[model samples]
Target chain A: MIIDVHVHTRLGPDPHGFAYLLDQAAELDVTLCVNSLSPKDGTGMPESPTEDEIRRCNDWTAELAAAHPERIIPMWYLNPAHEDFACRELEERLAAHAGLQGVKLWVAVRCNDPRLDPIMRLCAEHKLPVLQHTWFKVTGNLPGESTPMDLRELALRHPDVSFFWGHCGGDYEYGAKCARGLPNVYMDLGGGEAMNGYVDLLVEHETADHIVFGSDAPGRSLISQLAKVYGADLSDEEREKILHRNAQALFDQQKPANGAAS
Target chain B: MIDANAYLGNWPFRKLRYTTHIALLDKMDALGIEKAVVSSLENVFYKDQLAGNRRLHSEVHPHADRLLPAFTINPTFPGWEEDLDVCVQEFGMRVIRLHPNYHQYGLDSAAGSAVLDAARAHNFVVILATGLEDTRHHHPLVKVPDVPAEQVAAAVSAYADVQFLVAAANFSGVSAVWTEAAHTANVHFEISRVQGPVGDIEKLCGTVGADRVLLGTNLPLHVPEAATLAIEHAKITAAERRMIVQENATRLFGLG
Candidate 1:
């Protein structure tokens, strides 16, 4: 089964929001792990999401996932800065909607920041996978931006939790190398230029089992993103692991050990 | 559609194992790309661009039927004008690509203007590679920024008689120079690194007439099939698709 681990409903109210994503997902023939996004302007992401904004985004995600249980899988987006509030909301939301399969951490706090410890702890308890936003900026690693190394440190800190590094650390080559032997760390092929040789490098240097397919949809096209892996020179076995097997295995592990969510 | 932006030779930063002209053509053939305008990656990093262009001419010679040479010329280098003449006169290369970001030359400098003039004089199609790789993914030790779009637009406006193709201008980069690209008649864009929603090709076609866009994959650096799929999946009329994928470039380069 082809699965896209990264997708969003919409940041704002558009009559054609979830409908648009569903239609595209059908055309692309992949199950989507849909997340919520705060309202955004043309420039980029919305200013740090407010408490109400976070709640609304999570609501939208749950509604869509519940509507298409077979196709749409919900992943919660949290702002770790609002530590107590975020933790409260995640508990309330997950209890309310049992369909949430993962957690998405944006640039609200560095992956290594202690602020994320609570969220990571919660994920570890729930056995939920974490997809953290990462970008390898030219200006050097900024405060909020999560590099692959930062993710490596975090993944090492929480060995019980599974962390999917987003955008393959933006640059990918270094990201793949950093993720090599970290059993808990997985790489998602998302965002940025689909640099040539990057995917091959990942498969050769980093095990294909460690890489997952993610299309940062609505902002980018699925075909273009899929082409990054589909067009790469990889074996059928390696391609299968990246396209679905690995992601399925990750989700299959989310059994909420000890009835953690309840 | 003929790809207006392609490359031969190795890039020092990455192991693009498929760097030979033959490998490029075989890959292009697999993707159904009949022809492509090619250049050498050596030109991107080498200080002696003359030698790089010469190497490109020789490498592309065997497969001249499928690969058309786009020689790189750094205007700031001494004897660059003579090198340009050799690129056109000796090699008969019709397209001249400039890497101001890699070569460290201002697009608006006097030497830059002279290079544009020489291309115009020889009727060469000019491809200003706005960027080769995304800045966020550049090799740490040698990070190269994209050639400023503003400078490219200014140059395009300054030389109306010369046709300028902007290669590797992603969605943001295109938006940054939208006003200038819209007003300037001679400026065209190559859709190699343009990232947007599903109907992005159509969106760009509407913004800058379809005639102003060309098919480019930046192959050996990108997936050629991916570039083609983007065009094939875009919501556009057959005529508009024809213009973007082939006719515009064919006419611009006098491919006939």
Candidate 2:
């Protein structure tokens, strides 16, 4: 079962909107996609998604999955800045959608921001893996986007909650090194040049189990991302783990009804 | 195919275990890279670029039939003209590489002008390196600033006689530069750093034309095969693909 863990929907300010993405996902054979909603532009410091918007976005994702039970898996998007709202949203979404397996965070806010602690604790309590938008501070396009160093510290602080740091730190070597000792921290190979011989680095220097495949779709095409991994020199077993097994294992713990391995 | 911007030495951050020259050649051969204009990483990083360039020239000069040498020159250094002369006359170098940001000098500086003058006098093709990766991904303290497109354009405009090749220009920057400098016939853009869908190259070529684009792979950092595949599968006509992949670089660098 192929799962694309990183996808943005237009429930936010994206011009393409949701229906366009749903059609694209269906055509791409994406069995399960974790949809994320971005905040409106100019929503300065602590860019928070409105509670009503979050509910509507998650409902749309849940409905898509319900309509095609075998194809889609909804992930709850949470803005840690809205602490109480985040916890309430997670609780309500989980109760409403039995297939909701995990949560997603943009991590554009400060890594050490105390507001995220309660949400992290709640995710830990629910046994839900959190996919956080992460990169090295050097490569982060936004000023406050969480860096690997920040995520590393967060992973150390919350060792029980699984953290999938997206973009493999944007630069492969440094990101892999930053994530090395943090067992709770995994990396999503998403953007940037598809460097050859990177898989060997992951196997020799990083934990193979800690790596997952997430194509930052819409921004990048699915074919390009898939080709990057497919073209890499990896063993079938390692490829299997990176492509789906690792993600499946992460979601399996949450026990989303249809998320169970086929 | 002649690769205009190929490297023969180690990148400190490369994931693959450093392979011998023969191993690198075998890999390049499999990817159909027949002739590659090579440089050394030490030349790009270390204080003494000549020492590394000398070692690289010695290694590749013997097999000059397949491996053409491009000596790296840090314009910021003292006695750069002497080194440039030695690289061209003594080592038979046809191409000169500039790492303005790494060497701590602006590409538009007085020293940079001297280097360009010497390159023109010797008929050496000049390759301006923008960056190897997104700067935000570099070591926390070790900052490698991008060679700004404006500075590159200024340099290209300043030296109309000498041919200038810009490596690592992004898709948007390439288009912007060409729009203003389209009449600057000496300017050429390398394809390895500018990425998009396969058809993206065709669109770029339509705007800039095929002659101004050359094939380059930031090898050991990026996979050479991906760059080669992009050129190989480009949607343009076969003649245009040949011009981008092999003919243009061959003519620019005089690599037969």
lDDT of 1 by residue, B1-256 (tens): 6998999888887788568887887888788788899998888888788898888888888778778899998888888888877877789878999888888888788878888888888888899999887787777788888888788878887778888888998866776676764357878888889855545676688888788888899988887666788888776889988998889988888776
CAPRI class assigned to model 2: acceptable
Clashes of each: 0, 3
Lowest summed lDDT across 10 adjacent residues in model 2 chain B is found at B12-21
Top-scoring candidate (lDDT) = 1
Provide interface RMSD per model, one decimal.
1.9, 4.0
Residue A74 displacement in candidate 1 (angstroms):
1.7
Candidate that would win on TM-score: 1
lDDT of 2 by residue, B4-115 (tens): 7777777665544323457567767877778877788667777778898888888887888888877899877777777777877789888888888888788678877778
Query: lDDT of model 1 at residue A51?
Result: 83
The residue pairs in collision within model 2 are: A31-A71, A138-B136, A139-B136
True contacts kept of each: 0.57, 0.28
**Which has the greatest DockQ?**
1
Q: Which ten residues in a row have the lowest lDDT in candidate 2 chain A?
A: A38-47
